[model samples]
Target: MSTHLNDGSLTPLYQQLMEEIKVGILNNEYVPGEKILSEMELSELYHVSRITVRRAIEELCTEGYLVKQQGKGTFVNPRKMSRKIEQIGDVMGFSEACRACGMVPGAKVLTVQRCPVRADEKRFFSLDSEENVLYLQRVRTADGEPIMIENSFFPYNAFKSLNPNELNDASLFKYLKNTFGRTPTSTSQTTLEIVRASTELATYLDIITGDPLFYMNAYFLDQNKEPLLIGRQYIVGSRFVFNF
Candidate 1:
């Protein structure tokens, strides 16, 4: 790697530095989400002034190639995955969305157990006071990159046969469809909000604590309009895009 910059070139020093950094990113010299050299280190390595290094870093950030976390250093930005949110009839799962964006989808089951029904779960599942609900938590990924934390709830009696071991790296939607003949076709209700990541969520999504996340609550229904499941997802804000 040539770090020497031409002082005689007509191109500004900052632009030259920017190009070099961009090339480094393109060549996998700086992997996604990996922190880059500090301003002083970059200045020394590129033989440029601190101002020049700062300007280059700023431009890279503006171009979406880098991101600056408060008090933490600048890091490479992951490629944002885009999902189209249409009417309730056009619901898409995370795996389908990832494939549409030319990325591989992955999931790691974090927790699976039968838990006492919450108020909302009872209301959605029409469960009695004594009934419990099946709770499942997973770290959803795209191309080996952690993207979201998925917390899903299902009627315990209806899904008690689910094998926790099979959920690792498997699509719950597909499993429900194939095993129980229950297909989630549309969402009956959906809401989106912004929330700060808790420590556990940050660890799961590989983000800093208090980072912004897109919190989504959705009630899913089968084709016959029968309720199937409820989903509460916390997605990394900088790594996802939603089109309405």
Candidate 2:
């Protein structure tokens, strides 16, 4: 069946269309791997031009709401993983969490460096402008499968001198607790929508351009309630499932 668009509201036709489609996905009215109506079908039903329908569908696909296969119709995402905010404390480590679920935990440490903090980084990590940050970039794997690509920042003053090997062998949170006697007492996170994987990310995570990627921004607090770290994780849709 074709989705509908109203002409009475002040909302732009495209936006109205997008919102309706988003609601359908969230409400489980349109399920994953299900094909959405074709542009011609939608145009005919909405009494709008095929271009209008095409634009709406294209935008949706770019925003990760839908996917299109050449010569095939657009379909909903086939793999959507649940990201539990409440489980941050118990299983903050991606590898560990995946392993607990019977998936192998694997990671590739892409970059590890101690760099001067950016203005935003300073604020996020609760550091002074002069303080540096230990930046760690890694792509985590589950059962030999790529799942998440992460770029995390830690206050250099807090961790003293963090070694590259430490992050590679064990969870960063575990290292902080065991080596420094400080653990994450709590965490705050935000998620944003982003599309188009970078070439580097695409190669590492094994996804193509225009593929869906979730941008997860997180802040971890220490036992003393001080901000311990700030990070961004780019998770592949296939490896993640977010459930409310």
Candidate 3:
């Protein structure tokens, strides 16, 4: 509401402008996907220099509160999806987490094939070097918005009966539980890190190349403590949050 910036304040002009714009977004003054005022207009309105306005906008974009489109303008970003990391005994899948957040979960199967097992996969599943594994890649969505890319591997001999067609827009965990009587109850190991989106990943997740993403590698175990599968997920940083 207040367009005037106080030069007397200790905060830098750019930071002050950033906070004001953030407040506008939170207050719905700037709706998601709505193009915001140009830097020149913002500078004129706030009585600040163009450099100050540019810095504020840049920071907001980096923080995921805004997005800049080439030739177009800056727009407000959609709210981030959230997932909680609970105790070891409590594990939640993407679909379950989306449902809990009151969003419709969907998946688009990207790739399904049998691939030679990597050394790590062989060790995790206690398989021989000659064994192969069923690999599945999918783009997961919440309410029709692409959120993450899921790369999962299952022991071919045990889950060779899996139907790839059934995976589209379906819950893999639920399917495994009902069809194979195998429920993923826990994760033996999980590692989290940040990664830049590749061109292919950018296309899949509908994000810009080099955008930040959260990469997770997890080894899952069934209810009976049997090795189940390995998951490698690349989540859109601007559209997802991890609650620990």
Steric overlap count per candidate: 0, 8, 0
lDDT of 2 by residue, 188-241 (tens): 665566666788788889888667787777777776767878768888865586
Candidate 1 CA-lDDT value: 0.89
TM match of model 3 to true structure:
0.77
Candidate 1 — which residues are off by over 4 angstroms?
1-76
- Tens digit of per-residue lDDT, candidate 3, span 143-200: 9999999999999998889998999999999999989999888899999999999999
Global lDDT of model 3: 0.91
- In terms of TM-score, which candidate is strongest? 3
Better of 1 and 3 by TM-score: 3
Query: Candidate 2 clashing pairs?
Result: 80-241, 81-240, 81-241, 81-242, 82-241, 82-242, 83-242, 104-143
Q: Using lDDT, rank the candidates from best to worst.
A: 3, 1, 2
Candidate 2 residue spans exceeding 4 A from truth: 1-81, 86-91
TM-score for every candidate vs. truth? 0.72, 0.63, 0.77
- How would you order the candidates by TM-score, starting with the best? 3, 1, 2
Top lDDT hit = 3
